[model samples]
Structure formats: structure tokens, C-alpha cells
Target: MRITNVAFAPGHAAFYFDDQAAIKAGAKQDGFMYRGQPDTLGFEAVRQGGEAVTILLQLENGLWAQGDCAAVQYSGAAGRDPLFTAEKFIPLLEQSLKPVLMGLDVATFRPNAMRFDQLDIAGAPLHTAVRYGVSQALLDASALASRRQKYEVICDEWGLPVNAHPLELFGQSGDDRYNAVDKMIMRGVAALPHGLINNIPQKLGRTGGKLSEYVTWLAQRIITQRSDVDYEPKLHIDVYGTIGNIFDNDVVKMADYLCDLEKRATPFELYIEGPGDAGSKDGQITLLGNLCVALKAKGSRVKIVADEWCNTLTDVVDFVDARCCDMVQIKTPDLGSIHNTVDAVLYCKKNGVEAYQGGTCNETDISARACLHAAFAARPDRVLVKPGMGFDEGMTIVANEMSRIMTTLKAKEAAHVDQPLQTV
Candidate 1:
């Protein structure tokens, strides 16, 4: 089916955008707002309300398919696209993208996604957020035209088998690390508490003592409150490079710390994301590659994940090829088109690197659901529970959607199995 029309609705994303540069530069938090001038060009303050634009595509079948255009929480850093506010992008979407979307056939997903993903306006490609949301709309339209689930559309086009089971879900705790983590354990999250250890003074501690203590507490909490003896969840923490900072990027020191942290985790796998930022892609690869080699040499079981400086599909490939990280987080929005997310995940799997299909808290329900469909089909190692920082809300959205889709697919499979053979 073809897209009959396209419409745009400016709206709020589930979380706020933060000026990463300013925050790293020690912006003080005053309540929810950061009390400092913005360091990022598009940001008016250190932190501001995040915005999203809903792309609604009217299908020829008289149904509407929608997706939310959203940027990462820490935009304008790490070679990513600038902050995405609905007001700044609505006119461009109308003038440049609406016409393209209006007459496109949505019978398939990849070509349409690539068309918009690579579309140039004023000598530059459309913003990542635009491509992200628009591609999602096209995917939904394709699935609708085929009268199949979104995951089915992905599997069919990409030659991947639909996962009979749900991908592992990783939950984030935002700033409410302690309370929210308790909620995650109770809910049986496969990955627990992405402790947002962005701050050195408050969260990570000057010498990294704070984080070590937190890890010990996390392991103890899980042991005490777990539903069963086998309820061991991976302890994945994103430090935003603070660990690298405290140790002065000393690979040996970092390896020792990680090895010790693994012991503290005690029987659970540990993944540390963004251990260090080297300010540029090559530097980042070198830093992380050395750290990975160091950890492996020491026989450390802790896995290092690449996040910063790994924004696009090319970046993910570069990190994997360089053997810089054990896992590469395919941050969905940063990759622009959802097609890239699929490719990155598959590439990581092929290269013997784990893929974390991660997106930001600054997304909407539409984008989060679209991501889940991709995750189910691509079979990433783990997928982030997202669109908000609240542990419970995101958990509910991700878990319930997974359950609904899994049940539907399983019932269909059972029916086909029980059907009698017929002669043509």
C-alpha cells in the first residue's frame, strides 16, 4: 500500500534533554533544573524539556501509522545530531519530507527507510531524529500493508527468524538509583539498574569508592529480595567515562577496578558502558581497545561496552572491528533509521560482539514500541526499557508489549501446527 498523506504533531518526549558538556563541566542541579548556562549550542539551559515530533502516515487502507522523532538525552555531544525540538523541525518536515512521504509505496521497509534516511536538504542529510521517526512510520506502514506484526515485517525483509521468546530487557534507574533498582529486582528485569554515574563528586565519588559501594549494595539487595535462587541479573552500569577520568585513563588501574567490581557483583555478569571518552572516535577506539585487552589479559569477566564516540552504524562497525569493546550499544536514535539499528545488531552478533539495542530515556511510546519490534526480529543480546527514567512505567510498557506480541505469535504458530494438510 502507498502512503496517502503525511502529518506532523509537535509533542513532548518522556524525558528531558540535558546538555552533556555542561553537566560534565559541573552544572549544579537545582531541583530538576540545572543551574548553569548551556554549553551545547541548541540548548537554552543545561537542562530543558525534551521535545518530539509525531510523524503520522495515512495508509491507503484508511489506517494511520505513527512514530515519534526524538533525540538522545545527551544531544550535541559525541558526534551526535544536535538537540531536536519540535518547533525547530516541523517546518522542515513539512517542506522537505512531507512531499517525499506522501506518494511512497509502503509495501516494504528498507528502501523507503533508506530514501528518507539519505535524503539531503541544503546539502546535508535529514537530522537523525527525523530519519529515525520517519523510518519507524514507514516500517509500521509496511507491516500494516502486509497485515502482519511489525516484527514479522523486519524478519521477512532482513531474512531473520522471528524470536519465539522476548529479547532480554535492561532497565535503567536514572537518578533514582536505589529506589528504582528495588523496583527492577521485584519486576525480574534481566539487567538491573543502569546507575547513572555521570557525576564524579556525587555519584561515582572522587576515588570511585561510591560506585564500588553501590555495586556491593546492589548484589546484596538482589540476593536478599530475589524471587528465586536463579534470579541473577546482569549488573550493567553506564558511568559516562567517569571511571576513566578517576584513574586518568590508566588501563591497568581500570582493569584492576573492574576485576574487583566483578567480585563485588558476585555471581552476576557485569557490563560497564562508556568507561572513558577520548574526545574523538579514533582516540576512543584506542582507549577502549587497550582497556579491553587489559581486562582480557587479566582474565577479567567484566565486559566493557562502547557508547560514546560510537554514534552511527559505521562507528559500531569500527569499534567491533577494532576489538575495542565486548558489547556495542546500538543507541537507536543515534543510528537514525531503524534499518541501521538492525544492521548494527546483526553485525555485532556476526563479529562475536554482544549487541545492546539501547535508546535514550528521551523517547516516546511510539519510538519505544518501534524499537521493541526491531529487537524482537533482530534478536539483540539485550534491549533497553525506555522512553522514561521511571523504572515502573518503562517496565510496564516494554514488558506488556512483549507479552502481547509473544502471545499473539505463539497462538498463530499453534494454530498452524494443528491445521490439517490440504491438497491444492
Candidate 2:
């Protein structure tokens, strides 16, 4: 089947926080509007407009998909806008990609051929964000055309297993680290408290001593609260490279404390990610080695997942090949396209390293659905999903669509397996 049409929904609607005020006024009882970032891609806040943006695509076959491209909604913007969100590139999807995608054979589209590497975003007329949008829209449209879930399309076309529970980087939470801990737990996530205490002094309203005591208290509370839940929650404390840079003296001591906490919370695996700043090549390798050594000394089998330090598939392959890390977190946007991310996961698997399909805090259902499919197709050891406890709209439809596509693909494979051999 060919794509007959591609369309985006109307622009984002204005949102008001009347409910928050009502709660403060005691007009509401059950829940209060706790201000946290809205779910979006990383760039929404920085865009000239202060509105959340959502892009919807409708295929000729009646298949529909929507993505939240607003940057600030998803990524908290710790640093500069990632390459995908460069200012000059945002308009192509809003204007160009869709028209180009119409009437293309969905099933036969070759994803690799559409790679954006050749697009001169930094030179000539093409813009980086625009090219990135083209790639993303194409992937979305292709998935719709094939009637395949985006993740399954990526896995079938590209060969990677899905990782269910991807790592989330938790930056400083307002004034209280405990608040961050509580937020994660309430969201049904086991967290890694990386960099929270390490940069306490620099953070607003926090002292080093208070931070250390809070970490100890939080660790103990987490361990004690284990039996209270139906399934034991996972917890990993991130040093976020603060160990080597600012808290060198406390690095080993903190590691020992976390190790002890892990023992007390036995059966719940803990992951230590980015023990030191890993922006540089040598730093990544050194941190990986140090993490492995510490875990070994503690006689713990908890995994070490590399995030910012392991940026690409090659980095993941090299780290796993050298037995440097236990897990690698792959972000779809960071990888550019779904196909590339899948390749990265496959590479990790080939080398016996676990791969986790991670999500940003601001991701909407479109991206989240894609992540779910990736996880389902890859079947990683653990998966991270935010359940719809209060929202009422869970990803049942998206999940069903993905499951159907996978079933169809499996049936096709079985039929091929049973077919008689033909002479070439």
C-alpha cells in the first residue's frame, strides 16, 4: 500500500493551571497540581513560542500517529539543545517532509537510504533541525504506511532487541533530594540518585553535610520500603561524574555506602551510571573500569549503564567489547532515527551487553509508544513504563497495534519457514 495522505493536527492549545489554584484555595480535595515539567521532546521551552507542540500524521490506510515535538516538555534542558533541536531545523517537518512522503510504497521503503548524514545542516541551505525533522517524519510516516508499530518496524528492518527499563537521568530537584526520590517512587520508578548529593553545595538551598545525611536517610528508607510494594523496585544512584570532579574524596566512600545499601536491598539490582564526568573518550573508559572494579569488590552483580558517555552505537560496541559496562541506554532522538537505535541495541546484544530503550521525562505517547514497541520487540530483561494511574488514557491502543504487527510478522516468517525450497 502507498501513503495517500500526511497531515498534522491543529497547533497546540493553551493550558491553564486553574486546578492548581483551586487546590491551594482548598476547593479541590483529591489531588493538587504539583508543578513538574509537561511531557514533550526537549526543545519546547526554548522555542520562540511558549506553547507545547504536537504533530499528528494520518496515513491513507486510516492509520494515525501523533508526536509531541515540544522540546522542553520532554527534556529538562540541562545543557544546550541537542543537535536534533538546533534552531534552524525545526520547520521542515511543519512544512516539507509530509508532502514528500505521500504516495510512497510503505512496505518497500528502505530506511537506511533515508539516513540524514548527507544533509548539509551546517553548510549550504539545509538546516540541522529541519533535516532532523524530515528524518523523524519519514520514520513516522513509514511506520504508518506499513501498518507496523514504529519499534517493530525498526527491529524487523534493523535487528535489535528492545530494552524495557531504560535509564532516566535525574537532575537536581528544586530544594530537596528527598523530593526527587519521592517523585520517582510515586511515578512507579526505581531511581538512581546520581549527582544529587555530589553537587549539593552548588545547588540552591543545599549544604554538603545535609546532602550526605539526606542520601543516607533516603537509601535506608528505600531499602526499608522494599517489602511494601508488590514487586521489588529497582534503585540506582548516579554519581553523574561528580565523583571525580567535585567530590573526589567522597567517591569511594559513597560507592561503599551504595554497595552496602544494595546488600540490604538484596534481590533489587542497583545500577551505578557515569561514576565520573564522561564527556571525553578517556573519561568514559576510565569511569567504566572504575565502576566495574567497585562492583566486583562489593561482590555485586548490579549493572552499570552508560548514558551521556556512550553516545553512539560504536561507543556502546567498544565499551561492551572491552567488558566495560553491563548496560547501554539508547535514546531514539539522540540516535536520529529508529533504525540506527535498533542497530545499536543489536550491537550491544551481539557483544553480550544489555540494551535499554530509554525515554526523556518529556516524551509524549507517540514517542513512548515507539519505545514500548522497541522494548517488546527486543524483549529486554527489564522495561521502564509509566503506567496511567490517573490519566485514564493508557497506551492500550498503541500496544495492541504493535502486538498485531508483531503477530503478523511472525506468521509471515512461519509461512516462509514452511514453504518448499526453490531453485535459484
Candidate 3:
């Protein structure tokens, strides 16, 4: 199918669900903004009002598809270039990308993507938002043209020979209460939370005296509060740079922190993200490698994930090669190219780095679902709940999508099983 025409407009997305947040990435008050206001940390503030880039594409035979480009408030802190703002995607779509995208077959989607990469470097490359939005809309159009789910398009493109098996994935919820956790469980998520790095005073505001005490309380709450706990859930924490700051950048203290974490976080699986964002890429890698080495020597099973300094596919490769972290969060939009994101996840699997395909809360539905499709194709260790401020919307979309795919596969299997034996 050919992409005939393209249109785009500005939209809005939430920074967080609740009022109280640690990092304070968005503005405190409402204001008139042509583009969204950037916060102290240079994150786009759409809390009161920030913009999202919503895209519409007209495909051949009068078919159409939509996509929204959402970037995080703290895009810079997340290792994303801050200039990739929400409104930044508009011109790139109209001026540069349109000519290249106008005519292509749905089946040639993968190869067409490579052409996009080649087109990108000639001029200022389309920002991740621009790339993600266009790619997503095309995926939608391709799926409509092919009569398959968007995730199926990705899976087929990846040449996954395996059946669509049901897999367990986590819920990205900020609810620290029993009721909220229960709700997440009922919604069909695999784990309690893909927790944000709210452990800092600016956000968490003294969750407890020490990190261990706070973790102990969280563990107790999960173990005691919910009676319907089906799986041995993991306790995931995004520490930002709080741990390193608290320990004064001392690896010994950092090692001690992990040691303490092993005690409270062991009974349940533990994942710690951004234990420190030590200055440069080298510093961050060193911090991660030191932590990993210390954890191994001390027999700590806690998974250290690289979040901040590892933005793109190249960064993922560097961190994996160094054995700096146990897991890498493939922040989807940062990679821009869907092909690169998929290849990064596959590379991680080959190199023994557990992959968590996660992204910011600053995304919208279209981009969020696209990331979910990638997660399904890659079969990563965990997937983030995204495309909305609150956990419910993203969680529901991802869970339902997975359920539908599995149901379809099961029905196909059942039909095959019941077929006549004489044919064999």
C-alpha cells in the first residue's frame, strides 16, 4: 500500500498520574505555551500543559492510520536528547520524510525501514518521535492492508518461527497500596510494578528511615496485603541517582547498598535501575561494572539495570560488551528505528543481557502499543506499561492485546488438533 498523504497536529500527554513526584520534571503551575514549557532539568513540562505530536497518514485505497509521538518530560535525564520535544516532529514529517514514504508495498515494510535509515543521515535525521510516529502509522496501515495485528506484522518481519506462546510481563504501576496492586493483578499484569525511580527525597519524601526499611515495608505489604498473589512477584526499584549520592560515589558503599538490598529483596526477585548516573558514559559504565563485579563477588542476585547513559542501540552494545549491568532497559523511542530496537533486544539475548523494553510515562497510546508489539516480537524479560499517565490504560491495552493474540493461536492449534488423522 502507498502512503498518499500525511497530516499532523499537536496534542498533550501526562507526566505522571499522581501529584507527588520526586524529580519534579514538569512545571508547578499552568501557563500559556506555544510549545510546552521545559522544566529546570530541561524536561518538557506538560503536566499543566505539554504537547504531543499526533500523526495521520492516508494510505492507498483510501485506508488511513494514526500515531502519536510522546517524549518524556525528562528526556535528557533519560539519556534522550532534550531537543526531541513533542512539537519537534511536525516539520520533519511534512518537509523531509513524506517523499520517501509515499509509495511502498505492505510486505516490504522491513526493507522500507532500512531505506528510512539511509534517508535519515542525508539531512538532519528525523528525531525519534518523527521516526516512531511515521513507522507506527505505517505499521497500522500495513496491518490493515494485511489483515493482521500490528504485533503480528513485527513478529512476521522478525521471522519468529515459534508459535505465539503466552508470556508473563510486568505492570508499570506507581500504586504502593494493596488495593492498587490488587487492581493491577486483576487487570492481568504479571508483576506489581515496573516502578519509577521515586526513591529520592525530592519524590519519595522519606518512604522510610533507610532503603532497606522502605523495601521491607514494601515487601511486607505485597506479601500480606494481597491474598490472591499467583506468582512470586519481583520488587523493582528505579533509584535515579539517590543511592550513589547517598553513598558519596563510593563503590564500597554502593556495594554495601546492594548487599543490604539482597537481604530484603531476595525472597522476591529484585531489579534496581539507575543505582547511579555517574557523570560521563565512561563513569556510568564504570559504576555499573563495579557494582556488577561487587555483586558477583558478594553473591548478590539483584539485577542492576542501565537506564540513563544507555540511550541508543550503540549504547546497549557498549554496556553489554563491558558486562556493566545485568539488564538493559531498551528505552524504545530513544532508538528511533524499530529495526534497531528489535536488533538491540535480540543482541542482548545473545550476549546474556536480560532486556526490559521500557519507556517514559510521557508517551501516548499509538507509540505505546507499537513498543508493546516490539516487546512481543523480541520476547523480552519484561515490558513496561505505557502510552498513558495512569497504569490502567497502558496495562489494559498491552494485556488485552497479548490475550487476543494467544487466544487466536490457541484456536488455530485446537483446529489443527481436531483435524482428521486420515489426512496424515
The lowest-lDDT stretch of 10 consecutive residues in candidate 1 is 415-424
- For candidate 2, what is the TM-score? 0.64
What stretches of model 1 exceed 4 Å from their correct place? 417-424
**Model 3 Cα lDDT, one tens digit per residue, 1-424:** 7777777778766453222132333333333222335443543343334357777778777878776666554555545655455445567666666666666665546776655644654556666666666677767877878777676677778876434765566666552333556566555455555555444553333422366665676577666655566646766677776677667667777887777766876577888888877877889999989888888888778888898778888999999999999889888777776667788889999999998887777777667777777777778887877755467777777677777766765665678754311110
RMSD of each: 2.5, 8.6, 4.6
Ranking the candidates on lDDT from highest down gives 1, 3, 2
Give a tens-digit lDDT track for model 2, residues 251-274: 465456556555654565666555
Candidate 3 regions exceeding 4 Å error are 14-50, 83-88, 175-179, 185-188, 202-210, 228-230, 412-424
**TM-score for every candidate vs. truth?**
0.97, 0.64, 0.85
Winner by TM-score between candidate 3 and candidate 2: 3
lDDT (tens digit, per residue) of candidate 1 on 243-293:
999999999999999898999999889999999989999999999999989
lDDT of 3 at 329: 84
Evaluated at residue 39, the lDDT of candidate 1 is 93
Would you give me the overall lDDT of model 1?
0.91
* Highest TM-score against the true fold, candidate: 1
